[model samples]
Target: MTMSSVEDSTQAPFVAPEIVTVGELLRRDLHIPDYQRPYKWTVRNVAQLIDDVDTFRTYGQYRLGTLILHRDARGNLNIVDGQQRFTTFCLIALYLAKHTSADVPDTSAAALPDVGLEISKANVQDNYTYVSESFGSRRGDLSHWAEFFLDSCEVVVLTVNHIDEAFQMFDSQNTRGRALYPTDLLKAFHIREMSLEHASPQLRLAMVRLWEEIPPESIHQLFSDYLYKIKRWANGQDVPQQGFSSEHVELFKGIKEADPSNEKNRWARPFLYAKNYTDDYTQENSTLIRYGALSGVEYPFQIDHPVLNGETFFLMVRHYYDLGLRCGLFQDDAGAIFDVLPELKPVLDLLDAHRRMPTHQLVRNLFDCLVLYYVDRFGEQSLDRAALMMARYAMAPRVQSKQVRRAMVNNYALGRSSARPPSTNLFQELRLATRPQEILRRVLASPELNGYPELHCLFTTEEGARR
Candidate 1:
């Protein structure tokens, strides 16, 4: 693959397996880069981690997993692998250091014993409670456990110099642990790209702040399900069965370095140097969404947006993320469509009232196709009719889907399925539906839908806020 080919050209140094205590390792600056996902250890995950450490301590010395790091332009150790354990250990160390508090937030990661970074409140409370119980809540026992955790607990450290090789190692190692989310990899790559582009310290930190501000769930859905899906359809291609993944990230990444040695794609090099002038920067607003909607920071921009550098790339990410959330919420601003939005609320409500009904996915997928078609063709002016068409089209597939072709919901309100639903292949149909009129006509005329009942009940249900 690309990783293998890159490895062949650029040999990354892999250090020998040397064991170091948590205290010894934390003595250096170890940072979980802003791109990494937040510490989201469940109470169970935290309990299991501590239990493993406590169990290992009984054996004299416990060997923790390997940690992966890449030296950045500034020469800080940007952690790539072992984030889960590393962050957990740091939090545990802080708790032992009596640094837990709600009002005071820790954002420094310099010295190990003094390293103080804020973990999520829920995780801290849950984990500290678990640790208290795990060590029997005695001062002597706690002190001994802390010492063992800091001095005896050891891990193998792998420091990679090359960014590409580091990512390769990160991905490979992730398979043996908790996999880094695709977005995590994307963030690491873009940060390196920004450094390569020689972006200013202010600009680089700005992008980092922007990335960290975005809600994780929103970005995940935005990339994998929304923007990626829409982009493929716009290009008249079938959506990949795997949805968006690392490969798609490469496509988004494009060519990082121009082939000056071989001579091709010359414009790419100059484009990377293009800077965003503040006077020309403007507030971003889209039919799908507005910039800074989530973070409250208006992102700077460039005229015509000539280059795909880190800043612009994240700008693209944020733009599509906003659009995706709006589409999912059925909050499109198609002028006259506001009149239709209130009328369409019931359909969204019914699906949600049942926790998105017989098939949670069926409802959302149906909405995706419908919203995509509406946004692409008739605009929000057609939302009311679009909702109706979606409701009817959903029933059309019921005729054939054995999974959803049931009456259990009918015991109260009949619908989709327990697992996969009737809305499977529904996007292609909605894509073809184009205009609201076309959607209404095409769905009503489907041969498979022979004699489905009227969708009057779908409209009659009491309204609810959009999902």
Candidate 2:
């Protein structure tokens, strides 16, 4: 397919951006595309938006961000961006027009008088209750609240004809530093990928629920602790230097979304050449999206992605998110798991020491990787062995030389350039190999050095690790 951009000189000019108050913008039906994430603005976000509009009373018209829209064949305004702001405004208007609370403070709780619109969701009804609490502080006459909101607040309405054009424009906005998180984009990417086939909507919605259940702060930690590093190391790649930074959002590329039954999943070619990704990057200092595409699926760019395809990627993240929460990395104290499992305390201690290091540190990454790997493979009962194996590998005399040390890891099952995980037997061998140093040598000694992170027929340096 031809790669099309909104800025293509041959393309028609976009519909001019219009300065419109909420009144005019609300005059038409608007839709959030299915690929978008649910409205995740917490009460704090809601409070900020409302506080900004409160400025309109002192100042004439408050300029919120742009409202980007694309006209679908059915004439509904498909919000390409700014869904959060647009949805909030609708909720606010509806909140004002509908309910009147006596004891509760929602002066705007009454109802939208004659806007001829309705917005609904199963869970957001409670958030609307929070909206009432927030707006109740304004406590003016309930009657005029919708009118003031519609008339006082304004947004620049940017409408374009093609959805792709709208996305390209939306893409430009996110290339800015402060826009969306990589996880947020991954949420959208998987939602869109799932929609590509006959996947269950109920199942998809369930996944969204699980994702939303994760607190925003924990999402990054889940990636840093397990998903990002484990997946990268599995694919024989290093996690980005930014180490889960927002700029590295190109973590998952969408290559081909054909029916899984009919297709072997292939990674999408990413837009790695995008200027934002390569700004300070140069040849000697850089690792890229294992960068290129095969002949069958043609696309615009390269991305270094995990070997796990879409649904598998999503499921694994969900699994590890739960794991991190259980490991005390997310929910309770970072060391709380050790309290519950006195046995795993030493394992936790070793991993905890590396928790503050950069994720790119091979020792730190592999330690975290093996803990999650062992616990995930053999269950919590195996934590002590997992800890011992990691420490043994770290302090092994073979590791004393920078060469064989890195090489042993490079030669391990994880170091292979494949998305597949290490087999059960390999883990068992690791479990058995973590003995007293002399016995460990006896157990693992051989020219072939079968099945341990032992440095025998392997490449040993960082360059070898990359190889």
Most TM-score-accurate candidate: 1
Clashing residue pairs in candidate 1 are 409-413, 409-414, 410-414
**Cα RMSD to the true fold for all candidates:** 9.5, 14.3
* Per-residue lDDT of candidate 2, residues 345-426 (tens digit): 6545645544554322455445555555555544566455445555444333233333333434444534332212221223
Output the number of the lDDT-best candidate: 1
- Please give the lDDT score for candidate 2: 0.52
Candidate 2, residue 190: Cα displacement in angstroms equals: 2.6
Local distance difference test, per candidate?
0.54, 0.52
Off by over 4 Å in 2: 1-16, 33-36, 56-58, 70-75, 98-148, 159-171, 196-207, 231-241, 254-309, 323-328, 333-346, 349-366, 373-383, 391-467
- The worst-scoring run of ten residues by lDDT in candidate 2 lies at 110-119
